[model samples]
Target chain A: MLLIPCPYCGLRDESEFVYGGPARALPDMDAQTPEAQHSLYRPINPRGPLRELWYHSGGCECWITLTRNTITHEFEDDLS
Target chain B: MGYSALSLMGHAFRGNTQWPTLIAAPDMRTIYDIVIIGGGGHGLATAHYLAKIYGLTNIAVCEAGWIGGGNTARNTTIVRSDYLLNGSFALKHFALKLWEDLTQDLDFNIMYEPRGYIDLAHSDGELEQFELRANAMRLRGADAQILDRSALKARIPLLSLDMDKRFPVSGALFQPAGGVVRHDAVAWGFARKASQAGIHIFQNCPVTGFDISDGVLQGVQTAKGHITCKQALISVAGESSAVAGLAGINLPLNSINVQACVTEPVKPALDAVVNYNVGLSYLSQTAKGEFVLGGATDGYASFARRGSFERIEDVLARAVQMFPFLSRLRLMRHWSGTADITADGNAIVGQTPVSGLMINSGWGYAGFKATPAVGHQLAELLATGILPDLIAPFALDRFALGAEQDDAGIGPYPWLH
Candidate 1:
């Protein structure tokens, strides 16, 4: 299991947390625009270092952003 | 000598020392009428169809590694068309039909076995969903039926029937035509045939970048050299995003790692492919008696072609739960492949926003089954410049138009899809 470093609860088991997907900033455009739709649906899925959001559902139940390497799965820092 | 009985006897009498190469190796040309950026199953099949059906011989298939080295050689090899969505149902069944006669058409034994498949349901709600899915498949002229506990047990007695267990087998959706095939043989067979038809198969040549001029794709810059082409098709499975990015075109795809494993060879214990829907594990015994199995994608997205130990442990727990006897069988080997999953579960096919650049990717876990149909439809799109009805529903513009076809019913999640 992944030893996820949650911002509120510190390190916890992966099962206790829910993956919130890639942490992308919401775009400031018309919701109907293709650019806006893509930003909302498409994922960057970067190969190297990634900043993603995770929810400590079983613990603090707060959304936490974590910068980690998707390839290595090593925890970098909690960006909450 | 031809592969006839007399030639075989003559060869045996002559000590059987000489043999001809199956396909010829040709050097890459500076230009081609069409360039297929991958030599995997789908890419090679696309070249085969383009040559045999569309009568287009001026084609080239480029591969960074050997043929079938990517997901084509790494998948679980299960072939079925029992999807709930209409588009998937159509495309997959078309592939199944093509697979039935692929050996005869290519003059190569791909070992396309029609041993059938069973998707187990562990609860009433799951069974109800299977009922709807099976009905939908049947309505689309695909073969699917719901098997009760007794029928399911009769088909595969090894499955655990204890309803009191954590995840019991209540019932299953059986597709009689679903089965497994030899994955690498499909790619090799297509490559051999396409090569014989005068299509160049370039190995160890990777497309490093695209040579686009004025927003139009002019050529591809490969590791060898730049090769101009009238049209280009990117059939690279997991590297769809990276390849498209070379042309400055972004696709609605995410590359994630999915893994599969196989057990040591033993006596045949399972006849049909068994899928535990609740546990997210699917398994089938190979013709050589090794049990090949796979689980769901990793929880997070990554381009690394390696799986985490946690996912493997979770999958093994579920596998042992479903098949108690499997606990004793030692795992022989395991490997992972990078799968390109889209926000919608369905694939993205057709011309991109840029002219002369076409794509046939975002297959995720379903690429092996959809290889034949993907090639046929993609060939049609490349040759005629018109999207075939079978693949029009999977256009790249669907995400922009907000007309996504999420077959898995999981919205906007690439890993889940």
Candidate 2:
């Protein structure tokens, strides 16, 4: 059980949150080009630490960003 | 030695001391006709077919660890061909047909138990959807039927019909030919056969980099030494993105962890594999009397092969709800595997952006069942350089062409798959 640190509501259980994938800027929703598909679908997923998004659905219901290790499951609540 | 009644008697007389090893770990060669990365079930099976069917002998299977150490040894070992999509159903059913002869073909027992599979539907709409899927599966020569409440009860006597008050049992999709196989035996069988065919099966040989020049793959750089090959197949399941990245190619893949567990051995009570489709939980009793259980993925991308406690709790809770007796059994083991999931919930096979390099990956949670067909088709593709119709729809560029094979209608979300 991951105690994800939600910025709005402090640390919460993983069941209280939904995992949004790798953190990236939103792409053009209307663009249908291959580049757009690559942007939306193909994410740069490293096996090491990286920034990701998590929705605090059961808590504050707010999206929070955090830098976490994919392999180790360690996290830092530095980012808001 | 070819295993037979004569060999068995001879071995028994010799106290089984003269039985040779299953496979050999040979020294890596400098060059080969083909190199298959990841000596899991898929890679070894491909090597076996490549040598036996295509008659290509100059091959080597490079494994990061020992054979069958990866997802090949981690899956729940459910084999079925009741997919809703035409292409997916065709590939799996073809694999199912191949599975029927796999024990004989590989000259080893894979423990292919066709003990039937049942998918429970909780609502009228889901039953209709299962009917559509049943028709699709039957069209592809797979035996599928829709069973109602009484039929499901009769098929699984231990199944509680109204256990979950929120979602009542409406019907189920039954596949008479679907069951489980011995997971480790699959990799071992392929490794033994491929090794006998003179394919080098190298253990602890991790491919560190790719030898590509001008968008053409020359070979691979391993921890032992650089091995040159004419053609290469990247069959690394969850590491598809990482390995392809070595060739400067980016694949639309995310490695997510999926988990399964088994209970302590008990008397054999369950006869068929039962899946509570509405709850997304499944279980099957092994010949050893252990109840193998599993549920959804962890719903995140991670390389950690450890599953979350939340998922374990949820799956067991659902399992106990369906079979009340399971609540009494204690869990014996639990583990997870990194699954290569694609956006559309379909596999990505065939050529990538890099020439002379192909991939057989993006099999999120269902690669174990498709081992034989993937081996056969990918061997054909590597030998002939032609995309077989069975896997052409799963090309890497399908997402761009609006040809996504989202069989579950879950849209383009890897986690949802």
Candidate 3:
């Protein structure tokens, strides 16, 4: 089990939160381009350290961003 | 020596010492007509058909580990073709037809049992949805029967059909043709047949990079030595994105760990594969009487071939709910496999941006059921340089064309599927 440390809720179990996928800049909300489709469909997934979004759904309900290793499932100390 | 009653009796009388090896270790060459990147069942099957059907003898299958040590040996081994979509049902049914004659075709026992599959519904709404899906399946030339509560009880005698329970027995969708197969035998069978056809099988040989220039055919760089080939097929299931990345090709794939567990041996209790659909958990008893249970993927993207306890607990809870007597049994083993999921739940086959590179991946946790079909179609693609019509719908350009085969109706959520 992953022990995700939320910025507001401190540390919580993985079941207490929901995964928000790899953290990347969202395309313009109103832009209707092929890039929007690419952004929505082709996520920046890698087998190394990646910044991702997580929702503390079972706790503070705050969406948090953290850099975690995708293979190791370990979180870095710095949270943005 | 061919496997038969005479061969078995001869071996038994001779103290089992005269049996020859299934496949011999052959010398690897510096160049081949084609090199399959992963030596899993799909890759080996592709080689087998390439040599058998297409009459291409120069082929090499490079494995990062031992053959059949990956998801080919980890899945619960359920094969079914009752799909709501036309493409999925057709492709899967074609594979099922091949499976009927697979043991004879390969001259290896695969233990393909047609024990039927039942998907239980817990409510009226769910039953209605199953009925609609059943109608769609029947329209596509597959067998799907809707069984009410009483019929389900007669089929599965051990099931708890009490109405006051948490998940009451509403009804089920039964497909008599769906069943299980011995997973490991598939890879070994394909490898033996392909090796017999003079195809090279390399173990512990990993492809580190690709040799591509001017956007045309070249070769692959491996750990042992660089091997040149006329074409390359990327069929690595979990590492589809990672391996394709080496060729500077980006695939819309996310790898997640899907887990399955088996209980200690017990007397034969379950006769058919049962899916408690409300909980998304399914189980079937092996010929040895051990119950194999599996559920949804671990709702996150990770390459680690292990899963969290919470998902296992949820699966066990539902398993016990359906079969109330399962509380006494102990779990024997629990393991996970990295599933290469796509934005749409369907697989991606056919050409890539590179000229000589092709891919047959994004299978997620359901690749085992489509092995023969993928192998046949990919072999044709490699030989003729044309995607078969059956698999053309699964092309990578479907995403840009807004023709994604979203069988689950889920939108762009890799983990959810």
Candidate 4:
């Protein structure tokens, strides 16, 4: 399980985590082309650093981006 | 490490080799070519491998409860091979490779996503320690990279890399081959395939005793009937020592109960599973959006599988610190399982004193991740009636020498053994 760093909660158990997939700076509402929205909604599952949303249900109950390695399940960053 | 080596251990690897000499004819009818004592994932996978790969058809999987309901399904569902030790190098990576190809191998959708996993360094001291881990992986041919504060932010823009922040993300050690899998699916998939391979699965049948009269295993005494088998494979996880007790041998094992919980479902949230190696806790969002969390196992081990509020409280404080988005989600269900913790955290594989009995036991926490390796190696043991080289070190005598296989040590935690 990934010990995600919640900005408000700190490092918590992965069970306390709620996976908020694909956190975007902005929702893709202003796409000029259909392909842009399609690409926005459907990202690839490649290996690398991924931006993830994790909730600290076991602690203060705040949401944050959990920079994670999909392969390692290790929390890279605790996005506040 | 196959059956031939059993002679050296004085039959500690295979319990009942000469079935005809030990069991009576009446009780022998229930016997199978291979009788697996635990219906957990390892047992089921072993059965599947023997039946599918080795064509060892006549096998029966006996479980104390519904199959796959043991420690096999009680984990946080995380899998990885990033370790800083040499002994753990082969075993952890073997499972990692198997996890990567599991979906195709099992012919079932395990939802295995090998995105990656990261380790946070909160202090310069911690960063120095992570460098050792990164170096270990490099020596073992595993990919691991150290990320600085700026590089960490570029990789993950939202991280609070500032040193001034509380619990700042000073740096990280990331490995892009670790991931998650549907724990139950691995069990079900193996069971389904094993059963189809002419292996009979008996549920709610607890093995009470081994019908051993004169230093030989005749068969097993269960609630239903006495099963006489030529070979027996025992994969009982939490109750491994309990099963061994039937043969009048006290195994050096501890049954530690671990508890975990899941939250009510919500919209899809987290993309990858995250963990804190120092805190000894982790949380990940399921595909259905429920938050699954677990921290330290119940402090001061007991046989009780039930959990306490203290452990939960510890996990919650850390959870909130990591991600503040969980205050809204309601805690739904919590469950527990007795995990068979060995003197060493590694598994104990090979034959036992009694003939015809082989064991796949003592996986402290990584049982779910090692399902494939256990199955594959166990099958080889069962077919040739011998122990495999891969699992040879995880034998019964390691306990006597005070050798513990405690890997999973990510940071510079104190040496447990």
**What's the number of clashes in each of the models?**
0, 0, 0, 77
lDDT of 3: 0.89
User: In model 3, what is chain B's TM-score?
Assistant: 0.98
Question: Among these predicted structures, which one has the highest lDDT?
Answer: 2
Report the error of model 3 at residue B164, Å: 2.3
Q: For model 3, what is the error of residue B25's alpha carbon versus the real structure, in angstroms, after optimal superposition? A: 1.6
lDDT per model, in order?
0.87, 0.89, 0.89, 0.69
Candidate 1 residue A1 Cα shift, in angstroms, is 5.0
Residues B71-125 of candidate 3: C-alpha lDDT, one tens digit per residue = 9999999988877788888888888888888999999999899898999989999
True contacts kept of each: 0.62, 0.73, 0.62, 0.00
Tens-digit lDDT track of model 4 for B30-122: 667778888888888888889878888777777889865877788888887777666566677887888877777766667888766667777
Ranking by lDDT: 2, 3, 1, 4
Which ranges of candidate 2 are over 4 A from the true structure? A29-32, A78-80
Model 1: lDDT to the true structure: 0.87
The alpha-carbon RMSD over the true interface for every model, in angstroms, is: 1.8, 1.1, 1.2, 20.0
Per-residue lDDT tens digits for candidate 1, residues B1-417, read 225668778879989886566667887789899999999999999999999989998888889898878999999999999887788789999999999999888878899999998998888898999999999988888889899999987888888898789877889999999999899899988998999899999888899998888778888888888889879999998888888888888887888889999999999899888888864888999999999989988868777789677778878888888789999999999999999989887798888877899999898888899998899988998888888999988998888787888877889888676
TM-score of each: 0.95, 0.97, 0.97, 0.73
Error of 4 at B31 (Å): 2.3
Per-residue lDDT of model 3, residues A1-80, tens digit only = 88898888777899999988877678998878787887877757788787888888899989988888878888885445
State how far residue B192 of model 2 sits from its true place (Å): 0.2
